[model samples]
Target: MQRSRDGRCKCLSKVGLSWKGSVDEDVVELVQPLTGREQFFTASSCAGCIILLDGGINGFEVQKQNRCWLLVTHKLYVKDDVIVALKKANGGAVLKFEPLVLHVQRQQLQDAQILHSVAIDSAFRNSGIIVGKRGKTVLAVQSTHGLEVPLSHKGKLMVTEEYTDFLLKISKSKNGGKQEEN
Candidate 1:
């Protein structure tokens, strides 16, 4: 009754935030339908993307927060983009492809699970509900199609520029295949 059990309503927060900085342009079409529904509000989303970063192998994993993001783009990239980013790396450089991801906050746990089922059916196999302290319920939807390749090591190019270009093309093709479902 007090706005919500936690004195917070994600729906209202979404409304309060301006569209310009809150949601990615490419993701609007996919989340638009759910936005109008009473039980759901989009918390965040990304259509798909490729990222070029300078990172280190910290205890067998890439320290995402500590890495330097050389380049990031939601649209398909060109060969020149990768070439420029590689020149800036002082350590290891990794090229990664990230697939579509969306987080929908639901009014009820049941509603979150219902949306989760649909996400899984639509090939977002990694979709799951996130629950924690407070009454918030969120459904995280993600596709399993993602790739990461090491492009450099010790500030030296590990793979040829041609190979990196080929990787971008492959990642772009994956995005094309996923878009058809939405």
Candidate 2:
């Protein structure tokens, strides 16, 4: 899954997964699987783009925009042999790189520095993060009441005994469910 910045909001985008021995061209042919069409948009030699439409069959409509000239062509029935070979060459590059795209997008949003983020730890399923521009904090809200802590501190950091006591109370309440489960 990939999310791209669309104005103020983020949008999820989809890309095809290619098998082994597939060339750049073959991979391009798998873009959109509903239309049974393949298309390419190449802005430069190093950075060429392709779109696959609909379902399986190797034919493609390619657009090549190079430094010197622009070329466009449509071909039908790509050879299975070529696809197999390119698949081997390309290997798992797409899969490895695809997840990072989503990660980078999320990181960009987090790093924007406008707002802070609070991520709940997997162990504390009932807890969540609370963030704001001034400072971000994480709190556990239980049936009774709860407390929160600001994990980030600028300049110097300090921990007080009262805060530690409050944290212990929150921890006990969070663990109360587990005790009952056992």
Candidate 3:
């Protein structure tokens, strides 16, 4: 069962289904080292991302069901890019930044716990372990570093373009996509 789960993850990655199509460049280095380790394999990962979402009444906490991706990228962006993207917001437009996130499958529960503990200790406050019914364990490394800024209301830009530029720069610096010490 353990071997099959590991194989399943590898096959998914090879078939380009994990990231919807091919691996994300943002997390290549972060997960590359684990590829050779027989006991660990990545299920999915995204180092960071900046997304312009067309959300509705819920405001910043955009629901997955109703939100639309107006603009999305896993790479750092400049002010002008965001400014241009903001022009298309229909309603409750939200600009959000999400930090590194990784799901790793391990051979044993202890391995998952160790990785989860290290991730949590290293400022990945949302890190945790998942125990599957098949006795497969997965370590989810996630962070609390995320930002959401509402760009418009009712299809009209709410803030000046200059402010939008500043916010974009802030989002860029807050990406935290660089390789970590671990």
Candidate 4:
């Protein structure tokens, strides 16, 4: 689980937004316009996950960090320059890129459906949008493709580069087309 400050995320505070850290930079860029319409609010998110352990492939050791979320978002439009600041803040703690996952709270089933449609349209590929208690709908959106590797190895940064490029390419490809527009 990621850390939250007074029921808010510290990441949100660093960017000079509201105290709640419901959304991070990358997500803000991806969903700012929708948020402005008050259709939904993000509860928590994991842009990706990373874990660091002391063991290699041969054996096992203590896990330094277990399932840490790289980014979390809410509703504020606090952009940290495309998550560059968050990455920089991560320092050398990150070890892998897990699938992007988001938990969102929507106003209605229609809003959730709209978000689900947008998420699938954006190539997320794996989304579990369900109606929770009290008319609140939650969406768990995840990406099928991601980079997973130990940072101890050399050239790992190259893998990160490649992964980032891949995500951008797919996102752009999905956004540039009108498959459902006819």
Best by the lDDT measure: 1
Range of the 10 consecutive residues with the lowest summed lDDT in candidate 4: 73-82
Top candidate on TM-score is 1
lDDT, residue 10, model 3: 59
Residues 1-182, candidate 4, lDDT per residue (tens digit)? Answer: 12354443233323322233456455666545544444555566554433332222333232334534444332122233223423433323233334557776566787788878888998888887877566667887877765333333221232354444343344333333222221
Higher-ranked by TM-score: 2 or 3:
3
Q: Is candidate 2 or candidate 3 better by lDDT?
A: 3
Candidate 2 regions exceeding 4 Å error are 1-148, 177-182
Model 2 scores what on Cα lDDT? 0.23
Off by over 4 Å in 1: 1-20, 177-182
Error of 3 at 75 (Å): 1.7
List runs of model 3 lying over 4 Å from the truth.
Answer: 1-17, 177-182
lDDT of each: 0.77, 0.23, 0.73, 0.47
User: After TM-score superposition, what is the CA distance of residue 45 in candidate 4 from its true location, in Å?
Assistant: 3.3
Give model 3's TM-score versus the native structure: 0.82
TM-score ranking of the models:
1, 3, 4, 2
lDDT of model 3 at position 157: 85
> If scored against the real structure, what TM-score would every candidate get?
0.84, 0.16, 0.82, 0.47
Which residue window of length 10 is worst by lDDT in model 1? 12-21
The digit string of per-residue lDDT tens for model 2 on 110-154 reads 332221222122232333334447543323211222223321122
CA RMSD of each candidate after superposition: 5.1, 24.6, 4.8, 10.7
